[model samples]
Target: MAVTSEPVLAIDVGGTRMKGSVVDAAGRELHGCTRPTPRADGPDAVVEAVVAFAADLTARAGGVAAAGIVVPGIVDEDSGTAVLSANLGWRDLPMRSVLEARLGVPLAFGQDVRAGGLAEVRLGAARGARDALFVPIGTGIGAAVVLDGRPVSGSGFAGEIGHLVVDAGGAACGCGLRGCLETVASAPAVARRYAARTGRATPVPEIAAAAGRGDDPAAVAVWAEAVDALAGVFATCATLLGPEIVVVGGGLAESGALLLDPLRAALDGRLSFQRRPRVVRAALGDRAGALGAGLMARERLQAGVGSAR
Candidate 1:
């Protein structure tokens, strides 16, 4: 059921870059473009970059049918508004109309993580999966829950697993909460917290290396806490959604066996009384968000065509 009409312009707005792609119905990018996020310059500049990026791709692609934009924030998908992005510094942005006007194409707006989950379910790791979870462990620990082939964006705000309060009295989160999973288990937390305790400023990969050696007390303590917190969240998500698989992604998942081995063990122990979903790494890696947005755009166009017919 691949709709071979005009391609779509896919945009994924991240803290670091605004990635753009002109993609076909089958989730293949025809032309790729990216720009650095103007964090100091603010939201308007970012929007401008997205528009320029889309225009470049559309020109290269000859034309585009629609645009799909995935943003990092509490997105009000119903209204196509970015509710707030702490990292991107946007609030209640009317993103859909802005892009539609700029790019001159129908726009489908979505949360970045949710869109990634959509990509996974449709064409990536979770294809044919009735239930699955996509968790990206990077600067933060965010998740997207997919149930029965559709992501459960509960009241437009589902799968915010990072803010899940794992420790009531732990470190304060950016959302102003204390002892959040993000505060404990995110990649930055893994590095910075380990450094704070040991007074050694090593990155997460180095910390994992030390942990693998099994002698660094700082590595043991921080990695143990991170793994425990992450496992706790996974167990809770599994207990709730009972997914067939939980696909893990983001910068931290690159740790490979260092992450998977202890994570599996901890998750298995935590889910002793519950159904344990197989926790695996995401297949698409860094491109999941962009690819996911492209998939959603194709679906939206298909649905529109179906309804019209």
Candidate 2:
């Protein structure tokens, strides 16, 4: 019997860290590691780091055929370049070719949220939903709109839900917009705004805990605002996309029902004329992005072999 080999090396690049693993045919991560990104080193240095990360996984896998990299930004998949990434200081960079030659394997790349959404829609939360939205709320909020178990990357920028203006005259955002959803709803926003109000150096987990105890007014208010902002975004997406479910992931989802219960109720309350889909948390842990990257690699491998004939 001929021994078959592993398919691909998956790499996920975030604003602060890098993660990688080798995935088998069954969507299992065979080897994995997480490391902080030396982001200040510019795009060239980042490319080298990505190449090295994928190579390490390939070596550990004993052997792998190809690689996939998921990045946070407006990635022009057709150009195989990162159109721009505000967090990473990237611009029109040819990342795939650089990593391809460096790792000596065929490379597949995609926008991080889109890739993660694909994984969830196909293998995780919204598996059978005809239409779904995968939203990850952390320092920022973004989503992948899944249509028929596949992600729809509109203008390569469709899932930028965080930029939605939930408060027309509220707080200013890094994107130079006022009252953007991220300013009020993201985990960092929840923590920073709470700290600003209470003069306490509390983290997000502590803030959620304080809210639970009913001992912190600022925590409760901030948490509610975050939930409300999220509700606004969900309402808009539901009205527009009509997905069967909204799969929530990222650090904010860690709040469990604290985030979900209110968000679902708020969304449900707002829907007077349209059907409301259930808002649910993603089943995967922090490794969701890396797992999605692995699936992208596997998808690319399948596509390659299919086209070879």
Candidate 3:
């Protein structure tokens, strides 16, 4: 009798959507689905959606051995608590316990971007690098730090690099701070700044394209400000952590050389004693979070590490 292995359930919950998957041991996704996160309906609604989504994936997998879930915001992985999610409007929620109780299985829980960093190191762009940064810049900005081959959680407060102040007395941030890196460099910030400057609405890609051709002075200026802000942040990271590489993902990274080229140059110009990191694009795209969740579940299952009720 050939004993087949049971798959594991993986869910990556974001402010806007939840990605769920049934994954086999080899990191292959056997099945997958996405659902709106329903955060606007309130946090509890999002929780219910996740529970239902996980149950559906488990059922489709014919019973999963375990599950892993990752979410945005401040996640205390050791304590299995979601400390805070500004976007999701929740704080100090016992996420792992809640899910484990409903799912009736051992579960692994973590921060979404940290999970993405792990997936990158294990299976994506940052492979073979002991120290790296996986930064996903989209609706918001966040960083995942890998040090000595391990992702740093910092008791759920470690990776808020977006809140790092780059421009003193500059634009306000949703985090209630002024001059945050996110204020100047996030995807929306780029578009918003351009729109404010020109009174014309444009997407980031179009802006980057215009900037690339040097045709639109506004695009060039906006793109330069974003790039400069990012360089400032990355320069700080270089001096503080000296990561060997940086994997840039999310919406802004789609700009490719228009972003990375100037970023590398700016970062290099700032470095004298610090080892400059090789900045590159993330390989996994939007699926990185889900794949990371799967990797976490599979690794936990293999190591017999889980949150059991």
Task: Note each model's CA RMSD in angstroms.
Answer: 2.2, 2.6, 2.1
Report lDDT per candidate.
Answer: 0.83, 0.80, 0.88
Give the better candidate number (2 or 3) by lDDT: 3
Q: On residues 143-168, what C-alpha lDDT tens digit does candidate 3 reach at each position?
A: 99999887899889998989999999
Model 1 Cα lDDT, one tens digit per residue, 1-309: 444467888889899888888887656778887888887788788777777777888888988887788988788766777888877888988877777677777778888998888888777788788899999999887788888887776645788899999999888888899999989888988988998998888989989988888999889889989999899989888887788898888988988888888999999998766778888888888788888888777766877732210
- As a TM-score, model 1 comes out at 0.94
Best-fitting candidate, scored by TM-score: 3
lDDT of 2 by residue, 93-142 (tens): 77767666787776777788988887787778887787999999988899
Off by over 4 Å in 1: 1-3, 305-309
Candidate 3, position 289, lDDT: 86
Superposed by TM-score, candidate 3 places the C-alpha of residue 251 at a distance from the truth, in angstroms, of: 0.2
Clashing residue pairs in candidate 1, if any?
none
1 or 2, which is superior by TM-score?
1
Error of 2 at 65 (Å): 1.6
lDDT measured at residue 100 in model 1 versus the true structure, 0 to 100? 69
Could you tell me the lDDT of residue 240 within candidate 3? 96
